[model samples]
Target: MKAFLLLLGCLLATPVLAGPRVELVTSHGTLQLELNEQAAPLTVANFLRYVDDGSYNNSLFHRLIPGFVVQGGGYDSGYSALPSYAPIENESDNGLSNRTGTIAMARTQDPHSATRQFYINLADNLSLDGGRSPGYTVFGRVTAGQDVLTRMARVPTGMNMQLRARDVPDEPITLLEARRLSEQAGGTMTSEPVSKP
Candidate 1:
């Protein structure tokens, strides 16, 4: 009976074991990012940890460079930066590319230094993909809502780039909310609202 129960548990837990998909519902619309657990398990898992922990609630898109990228997941609603944790090891060699619409972790000039923040590629940032240095790890792709990203790319930007000394939006975009997407039998994961943060 114990063995049978163990097997049943495995069967019941298989779906969650497969990891999760996520959605970023910005002011423009919703974006579906399919996390690649097999390729970047640690990174994907860490991202999900942030989601479940409510770390990204009401975080403003502190940095926005039109035609470059839309960045957030760190600062709060009032533009005050949050206390960041230690840097994450670089996983740029995880076989994902910095192609347009792909989602990746944002880090400092140092490679292997990713943390809570992430960015969506507005253009093909081949330079950051290790040809010259350690590339940015591409942990997921935008499965939906590219139109919303395009709209974000068009928002006027200025010189308030986060952490960097260049290319930031004068008026930052706020990430209204973020949450884990529900599982589908055979369809892409869809998100349910956790809270408005």
Candidate 2:
């Protein structure tokens, strides 16, 4: 009986393997994202780098469009932005698709310009997946607090008449904090109030 008990204890003491976790604290509420590193290793590593380096802290969710995506993580509250390093290679070839509740990188016209900015898809964006240009690279998915995203999606937005851009919300939706949740380590990122022009 004593030997059996010792064997059981040893089995119980073994640590279970865990995946990467990302925590997002927004004005609405906090969301915990679990990254599928197996599916997106390079994408996850790049995102974690920004988190650890404080690149995302004090950034604003500058562009929001219901049923489209909520994009942020590179611009300050003032809409002034930091210049990110040369773009990472396009990983759109990854098997992941841009489905609802999935998080993906946002880039300029250049397919590889996706650096620090990211967006959560409110709907399945099939078109974003490599038609002519490379599609957005999906890295993770929301494991919790999706209602907060639903609320953010429903928020009213208007066209930026000056810029002729659509889907700019009247009120600012801030990303209050970001942190890693799983055994894998990362840091939090946030935004400040925007200054007037």
**Local lDDT at 177 for model 1:** 72
Model 2 segments more than 4 A misplaced: 1-18, 131-133, 160-164, 183-197
lDDT of 1 at 91: 82
| Residue pairs clashing, model 2 | 57-190, 58-190, 59-190, 178-188
Question: What TM-score does prediction 2 earn?
Answer: 0.78
Q: Which 10 residues in a row give candidate 2 its minimum summed lDDT? A: 188-197
Q: Model 1: per-residue lDDT, tens digit, 1-197?
A: 99999999999978655446787767678888888888888788777777877777678776777666778898887667776667777888878888888888998888878888999888888776765567888899888898888777777766543455455555566776788888767854666767423
List model 2 lDDT by residue over 39-149, tens digit each: 777778888777666667667777788888998887677766766766787788788889999999998888888888899998999888876668888888998899999
Off by over 4 Å in 1: 1-19, 161-166, 185-197
Q: Scored by CA lDDT, what does every candidate get?
A: 0.77, 0.77
Error of 2 at 195 (Å): 28
Clash-forming residue pairs, model 1: 57-197, 58-197, 90-112, 161-168, 182-190
Alpha carbon lDDT at 16, candidate 1: 53
